[model samples]
Target: MSHFGFENDIHSVLKLDMPITNAPMARWQRKASTSTSAHTGALSPSKSANRSLSLSKTPSKTPGKNGKTQSTPSNAGGDRFIPVRNAKQMDVASFLLSKENEPAEESTSAQANQQANQKAWSVTLNGYDLEEAKILHLGGKPLNAPEGYQNNLKVLYSQVPTPVSMKKSRYISSAPERILDAPELRNDFYLNLMDWGRQNLLAVALSEQVYLWDAAQGDITLLKKMEEENSYICSVSWSKDGNFLAIGTSTCKVELWDVQYQKRLRCMDSHTTRVSCLSWNDHVLSSGARSGLIHQHDVRVAEHHTCTLRGHTQEVCGLAWSPDGRYLASGGNDNTVNVWSGAQQTGVHCFTEHEGAVKALAWCPWQSSILATGGGTSDRHIRLWNVNSGSCITAWDTQSQVSSLVFAPNYKELVSGHGFAHDQVSIWKYPSLAKVTDLQGHEGRVLNLSLSPDGSTVASLSADETLRLWKCFEKDPSKKAKPAGASSSIIQQHIR
Candidate 1:
C-alpha cells in the first residue's frame, strides 16, 4: 500500500474485488454447484459422501505443481485442459491437426509417381498409342533404372513391348473399296450372284432394280429392272451350285431367279411378313421373316411349300445350314439362336446368352459342326458354338455391330463387317478367337462379305455402292526358301 498507494486508493474508491469484475465468478459458482449436485445423484451414497468430505477438506486457494493458484478461468467455457510437459505427448486438438495434414502429402506423392510411370512405359498400336488403348495398371511400383544398366535390365526391357502386334499379312482381305456412293438406297441390301461363273454373273435385288454385272469383262451393267414400287430387297443368297438365286424382298416373298435362262424361276408364297434373311444348301432353301417364321423349301422337288420348323419369337435375322446338311441354325431379334434337326423335327438346341439380337450366322467350312454368330444393336461380339453340345466355344468383342460375317475357306480365320462404318473388316484367328487385324478403307456400311473359292481373295459389297476386292497372302515366303546343295564333285571325290 505504501509503494502503490495511488493505485490502491483508486481501487478502494472503485470498491472492485481483486481489481476485476465478479459477475462471471458468480455464474461459474452456480454452474459448479449444479454439476456437483448432478454427479452426487449419479454416484452411490457412500461414494458421494466420501467425495463431499474430501472437497470440504481441500483449501480454496491451493497452489498446483506449476506454483499457480488452481483456479479455473471464469470464461474458459467448456474447453478441457491437458498438461503435457514433454512436447511429444499429443492432445486431441494437436492429434486431429496432424491427421488433417497427412493425406494431402501422400496424395501429391502418388500423383507424381503415376505421371512418371505413364511417361516411361508408353506404347503404340495400329497408329494409336498406349493411352488410346486404355491400358490399366493393376498393382506395381514404377520401374526406374539408370542409363546403360544392363545387368538385369535387358529381361525387363524385353517384356516392355506393346501387347498388340500389327502386321500387313494379318490384314483382312474382304474390306470394301469405294466404287459408288448412292444414298438413294435407304437400306444397304446384300448382293448375291445367280451364277458365279464368268459369263452369266448376275447381281440381284438392287435398290430400284436387279443389277447384272458383267463378270467376263469386269463391268457392271444393269441386266433387268424391277421398280422399287413398294418394299426393298433385304437379303440375297445363291444356291450351292449357283444355279438359283434366292431373293428376300421387303414383302417377304422368296423370289427365285434361274441364272441359266435369265428369267424368274418361281415365287414361293410362304412367309407371312417381310423376309429379312435367306440361306440355301444344295437342295434345301430356308428363308426367315420379320414375323419370326423359318420356312424351309425343298427346292429338289417342284412343289415348294413351307416345312414346319418354327421356334423363333421375333424377327428372324440369320439362318444357316450345317455343311453335312444335318442341322439348321436360326437367329432372331428375340436374342435367341436355335438349332433344329432330327427325323420328325424333334431335336432342338437353343442359345440365349447374347445381350442383343443375333443378326448373322455362319457354319465353319472345315468343322461343319461348329457354328459362329454375330449381331446385336452394335454387333460388338462374335460367338462360336459347338452345335452338337449347344455350348459356346469362344467369343470375340469387336468395335462395332457385326452386320455380316463369313468364315475363311481354310477355316483359319473369320471376316466380319460392321453396319455403319464402311471400309472396315475384323479378322479373327480361329480356335483361339483372337483378333488378328482390322481392315480399314470402306466409305459405307459393308452389307455383304464373301471368300473366294481358292481362299486367295475376298470380296465385299458396301452401302457406298461398290464391290471391293481384297487379296489374301497367308503363305509365308520364308518357309519356301531353299539352301544350296552340297557339290556333287566333292561327294564323288570323298567316295573315291
Candidate 2:
C-alpha cells in the first residue's frame, strides 16, 4: 500500500538541497586553461605568444610617471631566446606568462592590476620547489563528474529487526479462562442482571433469586429469592463500599442487602415499574425503572428517594454514575441517553444517537465526562459522548447488537458483549478503536459483563445460561494489582 506523503526517508522530508557554488569553480577553470595551453602548445593565445618571442630577451629601461626610471620589457628581440637559469629571468618569464592569457579588449579593471598580479604570481610559483610545482598542476583529471551519471537507487531493506514481544498487551486476554454456569440466567434485554463487587463477590440475579457468589472462595450463597408471587430479581448492583449489594426486583422495590451480615438492611419502594438498572454513588443508590423514572435513593436515610429524574420514555436499562459521583448517565429502550448532573431531577442533556434501545452505559474511569453507550440490534454503534457539550466525540460499529460495554479498570481498552452475527465478547484497544480480540465460547447472546477489581478478569453472563470468567484481562504480577489467582478459588465450585 502507498502511504501517500508519509512514506519518505529523512533526506526527502527535510529536503537538504545545498546550493553548489560556481565562484570557486570559475577561478579554477580559468587557471587550468591558461596552464594547459602553455604545456600543450595549443592554438590558444598563450601558445601563440610563446611561439613568437613577444616577451623581451632582456629587460630594458622605461620612463616612469615619477621620472624615476623603472626597468620594463622594451620589445620582442627575436623569434626565440635561449632559456636562462637566472631567478630574475624566471621572474620576468612568469610575469609575461601571467599576462599572456588576457584579451586585448578585456576590462580596464583587470588591466590596472595586471602588473601587480603578474609580480605576485611570478614570486609565488618560483618559491615552490620544482617537484612541488609539478604536482600542483594536475591538469589530467576532470574536476567534476562526467555528464549523465545518475545515482543508482539501492532498494533499502530494513535490518533484521529485534523480535518484538507479541505478548505485550495493554488490555486483558480476549479469551475467557474458565466458564461457570449461571443456570436460569434471565434472557431479558433491558435488565442489568449482574455486577462484580470490589470485595471480590459477584452478585447475579438468576430468575427469581439474587445470588451472591463469593468470587474469592469457590462458594455460592443464595442472598435473596423472590417469594412474592410474580416478582423476580431484575437487576443487581454492588455499592462503592462493596459491603452492600443492591438488588432490584420486578415489583419496583430495590433491596439493599448487607453482604457481611447476609440480611436486607433497607428496601426502597418508589418506582411504579420493574427496576431494570441500578447504580451507586457514595451512599446514594440510583434506580431506573421500566416506567422511565430515575429515583435517587440515599440508603442511609429513611426518606431514601431524594430526587426523581424524568426523561426517558421506555424502560431504563443501562445506568452508571461517574467515579467522582458528580454526574449520572442513563440509557433507555427509547434509544436515548440522558446525562443528569448534580442533584437535578431533570436530565441536563439528552442524546438520541442510537436507533435501537440504548442499554449499555459506561462512564470512563479515566475521563470524568466521557460516557460510552451501546445500542441494540437496530443500532449497533458504540458511541463515546462528551456529556458537557452534548456532542458525540467518537463512535465504533460493533457490527452486532452491543449488549453491554465496560471499560477495563486498569487499561483504557473496552470490553463489549455482542449479539447477532457475533455472539461473543470483543475487547477493543481504547481510543484507537481497534479490536484486540474476541472471546467466542458463548453459543448465544452475551447479556451482561462485569470486571473484577484486579482489572484483568471479566465475568460474562450470556443468554445461553452460562457465566464465563475470563482472565482475558489478566495483568502481569509485577503490575500494581491483587496477587495473581488471589481469588482463583472462586472457580473451585464446579458447575456442570
Candidate 3:
C-alpha cells in the first residue's frame, strides 16, 4: 500500500527551481540609481570617500566630525546600504555568485536528509529479509546516527526479529490424533461435525444427512438422513448428553433427531425465515433466524415451539446458550445483542454498541453471565458484556472481521475466526484478552468453530470444504496459561 507520498520502496523526487541571486549587479544598480542624489548631498567627493573609509573601519561606532557625533540621515528608500570599502580585497562579485548557488546545494542536502529520515523510519514485518528491507524505530537518536553507526547496530532489532521460513518448519504427516471423517456417508463435502455422547464418538452433519463414526472401531455408519419438506439444512447441534440432535434449515424449520433410535422425534415450523444459527441446552433448542427472531423449541414437546424471543430489528446471525441454561444471547445485522430468558418477549438486556453487523456470539462456559460478541466490520473487535447490567465490560481488537467465536470449554481462552484475513483462527485469553496463538491451515472463510469437551482440541469448519482439528497447547498447566510470545503455525500435511 502507498503511504506518505511513497510508492512501494521508491519516492518520486520533487524538483524546485529558484532564481539565482545577482547581489553584485544589484549593488551596482543601486549605486547608479542613487548616484545623482549622492552627488547633490552635503558631503563632497573627498568627504564622501573619507566618510566611506571611516564607516568601513568603525562599522559599530558612528563617525564623528570635530570630536562631535553626527547622526547619519536615512536614504529616501528608508534603508541604509553599507558600501564595500575594498571591493578588490574580497571578491565581492564572486562572493555574491557563491551565495546565489548555496541554496541549491542546501536544498540537495535537505533532500538527502529527508531520504535518510524515511529510510530510518521505514517499517518491515521481518517475515522475509529482502535486500532493500529497512527496520523501523519508534523514537531515538540512534536512528539518526551517522551512517557508520547505523550499519553496525540495528535499532529496535528485537522488535523486528527475523521469521523462520516455511521450508524450515518440518511438515510431518501422520494420522490425526482425532479424526471426524467417516466412511459410510457419501462425504461429498463436510459441513459441520461434533463429538457428543458419553463415548464422544464423532457425529457429523452434512448437507442432507448426519453420520456417526466410531473412532475406536474405525467404523462409519449413517446416523440419520433428515427428511424435511423443501428444507436444506444449514446448521446442527447435539444435546449435552448427545442423546438428541437439533437440526436447522433454510426453510426456518428445526427438527429434533433421536440419535439412539435413528429417527425424527419432532419437527418445528416457528421461524419465518432461514435459520442462521442453532444451539441446544438440554431439552431447550434455540434457533435464530434471518427474520431476527429467536425461537426456543421444547424437545420434550413434539408438536410446536415453546416460545419466541424478539428484540433485534434485523436478521439474526448468531446465537449462544449460557452454560447454566438461564439466558440465551443472540446477535444480528442490527448490530444489537439481545439476551433472552424464559418465555419473555422483551429481552432482559440489549447491547448495541457495535458499528456493523454482529456475526457471532459466545457465552463463556466458566463464567455463566459473561457473553462475548464479534461483529462483521473492518474494526474487527470482540466485545464482552455483563449480561445483568447490559454494559460492555471490555473489547479486544483483531486484524480481521470475526465470523465465528467459541470459548474454551475451560473458559480460560476465547477463539475467533475471520473470513477476510485468511482462514486463520486466533485464540485469546479471557478478561485480559491477550492473544495466545493463531492457527493457520484453512484457505477459506471459517464459518463455524467449537471447542472439544475436554478443552484439549478445537474444530473449525471452513468454506474450503474441509474440517480442521487443532490441538491446544497450554504451556502452563496450573493457570491454563500460554507462552509469552508463542504463535501457531499451519500443519500443511493433512492427517491420514
lDDT for model 3 comes to 0.65
What would the per-residue lDDT of candidate 1 be over residues 211-298, giving only the tens digit for each residue? 5544335456443444557666676777777666777777668888886677887788887788777777677788888888888788
Model 1's TM-score against the true structure: 0.58
Which regions of candidate 1 deviate over 4 angstroms? 1-184, 188-204, 214-216, 221-224, 420-423, 473-496
Model 2 regions more than 4 Å off: 1-175, 477-496
Instruction: List the global CA lDDT of all models.
Output: 0.64, 0.77, 0.65
- Stretches of model 3 off by over 4 angstroms after superposition: 1-199, 214-218, 226-231, 343-345, 409-411, 473-496
Write model 2 residue lDDT over 1-496, tens digit each, in one string: 4565565654565665845453365543554545555765347566655644433233366567889877655345333466648998889989888778767766467776886677677668775234323423444431321122122122112233422222232334434566677787778988889899989998888889877777777678888889899677889999887999998999979898889999988887899889999999888889999998899888778888898888988888989998877889999989998888866556688888799999888888998888889999999999988887888888988899999989985556788999887899987766656777788888989899999988878888899888888775544534633434554343324332
lDDT of 2: 0.77
- Give residue 203's lDDT in candidate 1 (0 to 100): 57
User: What TM-score would each prediction reach against the true structure?
Assistant: 0.58, 0.63, 0.57
TM-score of candidate 3 relative to the true fold: 0.57
Candidate 2 TM-score to native:
0.63
